[model samples]
Target: MFPRLKVCCISSVEEMRLAVRLGADAVGLVGAMPSGPGVIPDERIADIARAVPPPVMSVLLTSAQSADTIARQADAAGVSAVQIVDRVGPAVYARLRTDLPGRSLWQVVHVTGPEAIAEAERVARHVDAVLLDSGDPTLDTKALGGTGRVHDWRVSRTIRELLDIPVVLAGGLTPGNVADAVRAVGPFGLDVCSGLRTGGALDADKLAAFASAAGVQRLA
Candidate 1:
């Protein structure tokens, strides 16, 4: 399957429009987080989620630690999917599957080392997809997302080979290296944030370059 494109940290309707126009399969809306960038209010997330048209996923990104809390936040935001940014227990995911039926729950697996592959395997059973990221939630400041550093693609490829579910790759992806990343990791999707931005704002040229490099053509 062709690798899909997801533009994260979409803060406004304008950013959503830009992302959809650039052929993004999904757009991430950041909710409250303990650290890192793109932390916005749930109310704002709801407004953007409502405005997003069909065929484009409005993903609510959260740092909530429990299944119930994440489910409630996703429900209240009215988003199509919930991207879990924290390292929650397996029971939490089990609960999410029951509580948020029909809604996609994406678990973020920070590739701190080879152990991440095992973590991905464990979490894959509960969530629809596993996103391999470069953030270390263990840090005292907690760098969940928006960290412009790439994880080991070789490890990601091993994880992808092991899991039956789709694996999405994130962290430090840019127009210059997305094609290489696709070849190396072979992930089902690519999620970008800081790579497609300039001066803390989404850059149209960068977005277009990234989409094109990722083989996502603009919809007519």
Candidate 2:
């Protein structure tokens, strides 16, 4: 029922370029973050949106508290979609669910294992799609995603199977295991962050290499 993801988590324009060049289907723009993994300003997300050429979707990573405001911000920036946190209430989710219909509003849920995943799989129905990430919020940083931790592929695989919607896998994935992941999870798409970057920033070469190997051809 939902599209799979070949998503790339990015925080800067350079990384956006790499995602575009290397053929990423989507980019996760960090909207609001305190000190760690997603340390990007709202303005920067706008900049990244402009930088991403057509066909490459932009998913604004916003907290539940600011999903609405950030959704507006994402629209102004011309982003493709907004990936809201699970805490997003029904009202916000409904508003965002169809805010940009035909586009998308992904939900990022933290599922550590099968039971947690089953619960998430049920709640995951609220949004258009689901993204699997690290459960702990304390370890979040501006430079990485999914705690830069390798979540069990089994979780992604189960969710993908349970949900008719697209399931995007984003925990810890690299070129080395990406292909295997694509096959193992059988998800609509895969997302990458710290695994493909260098020093918390995108490495163009690595980005390209990973993209090519991942089979999600570059857009332009």
Candidate 3:
């Protein structure tokens, strides 16, 4: 099977539906963050989470630091899974694993260098998946995501080879380059946000093109 497609940063119910129609295996709803795009209210996140039908996962992107805080926020948001953007300790993940039993946890690894390989391996032991991205958290404003700059797929490919868990490649992916990314990285999934949008809204043409490029003919 082809790699799964996760449409991230979905701001509205309409966007979620459109993503589903375009063959998204999962839709990401950003809850809150220190700095980034697609930050929505808890109520809206919960609404979108509840509105999503089965088999299509509702992922809540969060920047909460602690396991307790993330657990509380994810529970309130009513999402099927949580994609943690911040760098949290292993203990936090262990706590989350115990606290949020049924819920899935996905960790985002900012591919800065070879160190990212070890980081991905460590995170993979705790989380369901590791998303390799290009965001630099140490920036003045901190670009956790939505930078639209492609990272080193070679590094991501190394991370994919080192881990037993799935690795989803993100950061600056579009229909034009998705095929190349898939071949180069061989990721278990692809998480796209800015690549599928135009003027800050989801574009049907881009979505269709992306799905075709990713070989996602049907969502199910």
Candidate 4:
């Protein structure tokens, strides 16, 4: 199992490349936004997945879709892994697990209330890893993952303790306090959306600063 606490950024190809150039360990390809900051067209995700060079794994984001459909979509898009969020429970995750044909599925759990951690822990075996998101980004919410607000670190920490797989902590993470998150929760990795943006899109300078705070090593 991978033990490094790497940092990942989510956006289009331009932003993804910027994050990579700066110091992001990985980049996420927004799948079906419908609502959220990381929404990109399916074609865009496919293009981005192809554009990113090897070793820097590209991830796909999806909402509460069926496992078979999601797996197929991720495979079709050629992403290394699929990130699933939207208040799915253990049964749904378990059911989705069967849909993963050769693709890896990363379950993104929204830690809004006190029970989210427990729910995520219960569904830990259903996926490769779990991503802690927030409830603020509902389908109606215009800004998906870029609410610019942080959730309770203890929630992520608790979930991490319950699951053996890697945990990717997201939601309102920035260069300013990512280190605090790292120190507090000790997650397997970090995922950022709006924190690395200049305008509405991804920002090169912010990306660099976030990568630094995330502890991503500079490439030679």
Candidate 5:
């Protein structure tokens, strides 16, 4: 089966609609981040989330680590799911299970090296899915996501093979290299942000090309 497509860093409801219309299975609404693009306000995130139609999920990308804080952000945004950009403890995931019932929790594992394999394995059971991205969270400023840099797909593939949960591959995925990524990682889904945008805006042509390249069927 073709991997599901997720368009991230959606700045508005119009962008969200466009992404869904163009065969995106999910849309990512970025919350406040220390460093990265598409850091929209919580109110805007909530507004976009409310406008999202059913079956096409609205995901909130949050840097918040605490369970209560993350739960509050997710609740306020009213998103279908939450993507934790930073590493958090198992307790946070456990608390989120209760605090945000029925909502999907996705954990981001920065594929830095072989250590990423162990990191992803450790959290695979806690989240509904694991997203492998190219980011250095260890940096003083912290690059959580939206770096537009591709990481080692070999390491990502290792994580995918090890995890029972679905794996979503992100980072530097574009119309140009999505097929190669799919071949290498064979992830359950593909998430794109900067790659699908041009001049800080979602490019329709790029989105279309990416969907076609990824073999994603347009939503009727």
Candidate 6:
């Protein structure tokens, strides 16, 4: 099957609708984060989530570590999936499984090095899918997602090969390089944030080009 398209850092209901109309299979609404772009209020996130039509997922990008806090944030946002942008233990995932029964839990693995392979493998069991990103949480001022930088595709490709669940590739993907990313990693989906935006606003032309490059046909 063709890889799915996910547009991230969506700030408003209008952007969400545009992404869906342009063939995005999912839209990412970023919640409060220690350091990252596109962090929006919970109320706005909930509004966007509610506006999203079926078959199009509303993914919440959260940095909450505790399962209870994460679950509460997810509940407030009313998102279909939660993308954990920081490292957490297995216990947290286990609790999330029970707390958010039917919702999808996606873990973000920062591909800083070959060690990321082990990290992805460890979390693969808990999450419904793994999203490989280019962010360093080790920094004093944690750089989560929305870095707009690319990581080693070879490492990302290895993670995709090792995992049984779907893998979504993020970080610095653009209309120009999306095809190369697809060829290199062969992820189950493609997630783009800064690449599809111009001056922090979602650019229709960029979004369309990105979808086309990723082999997504415009939704009828």
What's the lDDT for all of these models?
0.89, 0.69, 0.88, 0.70, 0.93, 0.93
Off by over 4 Å in 6: 1-3
RMSD of each: 1.5, 3.2, 1.7, 2.8, 1.5, 1.3
Model 4 whole-model lDDT (C-alpha atoms): 0.70
Candidate 4 residue pairs in backbone clash: 36-144, 37-144
| Steric clash pairs (candidate 1) | none
lDDT digits (tens) for residues 143-167 of candidate 1: 8998999989899999999999889
For 55-132, candidate 5 gives per-residue lDDT tens digits of 888899999999999999999999999999999999999999999999999999999999999999999989999999
Query: 1 or 6: which has the higher TM-score?
Result: 6
Model 2: lDDT to the true structure: 0.69
Count of steric clashes across candidates, in order: 0, 17, 0, 2, 0, 0
lDDT of 4 by residue, 62-138 (tens): 77466567767877888777777655556666665566555566877777766887778766777788888765444
TM-score of each: 0.96, 0.83, 0.96, 0.86, 0.98, 0.98
lDDT of 2 by residue, 1-220 (tens): 2323344557778767766666776777776554336557778878888887666677777664554685676677677777765455657766666666665777777756676576666656677778877655434433224467777888778778888777778777877787888888887777777777788677777777777667766656
Task: Tell how far residue 130 is off in model 5, in angstroms.
Answer: 0.2
For candidate 5, the lDDT comes to 0.93
TM-score of 3: 0.96
Error of 1 at 88 (Å): 1.2
Worst 10-residue lDDT window, candidate 5: 1-10
Backbone clashes in model 6, listed as residue pairs:
none
